[model samples]
Every structure is written in C-alpha cells, then in structure tokens.
Target: MRPLSRRELGPLTGAAVLALAGCGASEAVPPQSTASAGEGGTTYPLVLRNGDREVRFERAPQRVVSLDQGSTEILLSLGLADRIVGTASWTDPVLDSLAAANEGVPRLADNAPTYEVLLGADPDLVTASFGRHFAEQGGVVTRDRLAETGIASYLSPTDLDDGQSVNGGKKARTTPLTVDSLFQEVRELAQVFDVAQRGEDLVADLQRRAREATEGVDVGGRTVAFWFANLDTPFVAGGKGAASLLATSTGLRNVFADQAEDWPSVSWESVVAADPDVLVLGDLRRDRFPGDRLAAKEEFLRTDPVASVLSAARAQRYVALHGAELNPSIRYVDGLAKLGAWWREHGQDL
Candidate 1:
C-alpha cells in the first residue's frame, strides 16, 4: 500500500496532538522510572523489548486498544476483555470465532485507523500483531511518535521485519516460528497486563497440546507444501515459519524448508521438483486485500498452467487451514492439533 503524503499528515497530526493534550493524565500515562508488583503480583513499571522498540508499561493499561486480531485475542485470553476499548482489523475471523468474548468491544476500523481517529479513543496502549499496523502506509501514530506522547505499543515477534534493526541495533528475530516463541509473546504480554499466572497457564496448556499432537504421529516420509497465498505463483511457507513447525508435529516435512525467510515465494517449477506428498492450502478471505480463497486456490492447483499436474494437486491431498490460524499466536497449538489429526487420517494413504 502507498504511504500517505506529508500534506495528508499535517492536519491529522495536529488533531492527534490536540487529543493528546486533552488527555488529563488518564489516557497518556508515562512509563515510571521504578518497578513494583501490581495486580495478581505482576511486576509493574515493566520494560520489555517488543519488536523493534523498548516498551514500558507503568501500570496495567486502563483504556487498551488492539490494533489487530492477534493482540485482541491475546488480550481476551488473559482476561483483559474489560481493559480493551477499541479494535481494528480486516474482518478478523479469529475475533469472529470468539464473538462471545469480544461482544460490545468498539470496532474502530476495518484497517489501521487514522491518527485523529486512533487518538479519539484516548487509549493508553495500542497493541498490534504486526509492524504494519503502525506503518506510515496505514496512518499517523507510528511507534516513535506514540512513544513521544507516552502512549505505548507492542508488536508480535512474528510480525517484525526480518531485516529491521530492533533494540540497540539488533536485527529482528523473525524465524523458526516455534511454539515457544509464540508462548513467549503470551508470557510477555501477560506480564504487560499483570496477568502472569494466566499467561503461564495458557502457555502450559499449549505446550501440553503440542506435545500430544506430535506424539506417536508418523510422517510416513510425506513432504508437504504449505501454500500460504497465490494466484499464478505460490507464496509458500518456508521451512523456518509456523507451517514448518506444525509440519514437524505431524511427522511431515516441508518441501520448502531450505530457505531463510519465514515465508518465501517459489516458482511452480520448484514445486514440481520438490514433489511434495501433501498440500496445506491457507484459506484467506478477501476482507482487505483480494485474498486467495481456499476453493479458488484448490481449483487453480487442479487446473492451472503449471500447478494442475503437480503430484500434491492431482492426489488431492490437501489440508485446508484458515490463513489467520497459521499466524504465530495463541492458535498455534490448535494448528498443531488440526494438522496432526488431518494427516493421521488422510496422509496414511499415500
């Protein structure tokens, strides 16, 4: 997406400044210089590295707004539903699935809100799943600008750009998307919201589920191609991401597991050469961008110029998964279970 022009930023920036000035210390709580224990014995004035910046939570956020579904779900899982004031996304199906938990939460925007609109919520903290949520392409309120105003932010470890420098010029950690990395986000956020026990408990449960999912699952030497998104060319889940982690649990191997990128685009010729035994089509709805629908993607594989004759396509060995589920978040364990179950039943045939 194209970034907004400087001319577009001037007025919105002014409105945001006004909104910040209007907040009487309630909406704009500055990070404290000292740390102390708070609710449920969670340490306060907590400082942690989230994505590319240092975030300090002086106290539990009063008016929290989730900038994406991943953060929204994480907040809810930690029993912070009452703390959330606003949410924005491109029709997050995960939030939709947890509709009862998210009932009455303010729907801020279908995508990232403008600076004026974001500030109107009087939010103390804005949590996001991806760096793009704070991207200039989205609108005003970049993390640095928000920090100057004492409003804090967070970015999921999985969402930071791999090449970007974070926290004292260290390159961002953006690979081998494992369950521990996902749970670390939960534990870290749990600390942020003063819900350490709940976070630990969730992490333990996910750990147990993942263990059980992988236990006794035989791969039968069937390599898989986790097709993330594409129309003509396939944008695949490379070896170092969530898809590969899930594949490990199911005893299957990822054909694209030799790359450094978390998710890498590959030619169908590569797919042909790899000759994966199974396919995992990530089903994405066309909410914001024109997403590649599951049905359409399957059809393309069966009828396209190159993909039509691929072994995985002809065999019809596809494990359909929600695009959102594959994102490194609370649902990662669910992904393990889903793939484990599907492959156990279907993958045994080949």
Candidate 2:
C-alpha cells in the first residue's frame, strides 16, 4: 500500500496519534536562521527544523518543490503556487482558482519520487513535513543528498525529537503543540518566500479574530469531547493537539483536554465516565458526509450508554465537521471562524 497522506490515514490509522506523540512543545524560534544577501534579492534562506537537521535558504526559491501535503498547502496559502514547480502527492483537490497554477507540476514518482526526477524538476528548494520523506533507508533522497544536488529542504517541528521521543521508540510524552508554533512555521516559510510582512499581517488577523471569537462566550460549564470517525473504537483528540486548539479557540471546553497529547484511543466506557456536555464529531466522510451526518453521528453516540447520558446528547448538540481541515495551517482560521459562528448561533446562553 502507498504511504498514506495525513488525511487518508484517518481516525483509525493511528498515524495522527503517532504524529501527536512526535510533536514537541512549541519553541520560541526556528532551530536555524540565515539571510541570503545577493543579486537574487530574495534574501531568504531555507530554515529547516524537525530535530537533527537544520538549514537556511539564501533567496526566495523560484522553482520550488514540495514533497508533502502540509508543506504544499502552506505554499498555496502563501500565494506561491506559481513558484511551486512540482509536487509528490496531493490529498485534497486543488481549488479551481489554483488549478491552472499547478499545471505541469509533476508527481515525481508514485509514492517516493526518485532523485533523478527531483533533480529533473530543477527546483531550488524541496520541503516536507516528515523526515522519512526526505530520507528513508535504501537510497532515499536524504537531505545531505539533496543538498549535494543543489537543493535545500525542511521538515516541520511536529516531527522533531525535542526530548519527546522515548529511547527511539514511542512512549507517553505530553508536550503541548501550540498554534504559536505553527504561526512561527508560517513566518519561516513566509521569510523563505520573502513575504514575512504579509505573513505577520495574516497571523495578526487570525489571532485577532480568534481572540474576538473566544471573548465572553461561556460553555455554560459544559465540557466537550472530540470524536473522529469510529465511535465504537472512540478515537478522541487529546488536550494539547490540534483538536484542543480548535475547542479552546472556539470557547468550547474540551473534556479530553485533560488527556494530554493528540489523538487518543479511548473506550465507550470512558465517555460515559466523563459525560461531556457536547461531542465534537470530526467529519471524515469526504464522499459519505451529508447534512444529516451530524444527526446520525449523534445517534451513534447514543449507543454508548455512557455517552447517552451526557447533557449534550439530551439536547442533541453533536457537531460534524471535516477532520482533515482542523490541522494547523492557513485554513485553520477558516475553521475557527466557522466554529465560533456555530457556537454563537447554536450554543450561546445555554
């Protein structure tokens, strides 16, 4: 099977859970920094961070190549779609406005593109979120190898070690993943594109809106729990991950906020014990989601005798939203805005 894109992994894939564990607490700054001063006039050096590897770009990358969805999405949000010469894999369909811009951006190879194809793209920079994408065992395009080919790369901080890994294995590490960290990444990428000023403006706007939305909206002391797809297995979003950010941003109290880290698999019995006020069901059904999916999900929640007793159920307050869209990115602001609107329209003064 092909290595799954983050969204394709879904709630059952356990990839999000693993990714969450890999994520470290937000850092005050990028791991490395540099300014490119030259005729290129871009003055942006690629800054790479995700543990052991670090890099800097000297100019705005003209012929850019992104190897992962998150990095590609970030580039699109920065309005650098024209600069992106190639992509490896894509999850969501490109919006119509940007589809023409992405034309001829080759897929490199099926899953992991080869070095010759990457070099063929003649890109100045190659970016990704996972270290494994850049380097795996067996002749994979290592960062050093790519640099040797005159291309620089980066990995997101979410994949860094930062003392979050346990003896090179998985363990219970509860570091917080903050929106601030994602903002910093955006800033770094903006700098790469020589658009830091624009990035700062966008962040300010998003922060202001998020702050405004959260103002004075009490949840009436009701707590919330996030449900991804499978209710029987009870895949839940934990306190310090993307889901927590959404809940906290929208002024809803996440009942699983106490469960530190990202996606956590819990039992139906656990939901009964917590008896949260509302259930945030992340809509993963791209093809199957309907207007009534929320209602159906709520009905499914009722099957859990433990969850059935919650105040949210009695009032039928279950909410369905696209799951993949909730991750930290430019679109996060859109999600927050929608959530705030929902809370105000249906949840206020409860």
Question: Of the candidates shown, which would achieve the greatest lDDT relative to the real structure?
Answer: 1
Task: For residues 1-350, write the lDDT of model 1, one tens digit per residue.
Answer: 88743224432432222112221242333345345676657665556766545665556767788887777888887888888989886433754547787886887886777777787777777877766656655444677777666577777766554534221132224456556666777888888777899998878887887789777777866788888776656778877766777777677888888875666677888898888888888877654333367878877877777887888788898888776677667776767777878867876588
- TM-score of each candidate structure, all chains considered together: 0.81, 0.68
- Residue 318, candidate 2: Cα error in Å is 2.3
Per-model clash counts, in order, read: 0, 7
lDDT for 284 in candidate 2 is 49
Task: Summarize candidate 2's per-residue lDDT along 269-350 as a digit string, tens digits.
Answer: 7776787767777654332323224445677756756667777777877665555445545556656766666677887546
| lDDT values, one for every candidate | 0.69, 0.60
lDDT of 2: 0.60
Identify the leading candidate in terms of TM-score: 1
The local lDDT score (0 to 100) that residue 46 gets in candidate 2 is 37
Candidate 1 segments exceeding 4 Å error = 1-36, 90-92, 95-97, 136-140, 160-175, 287-291
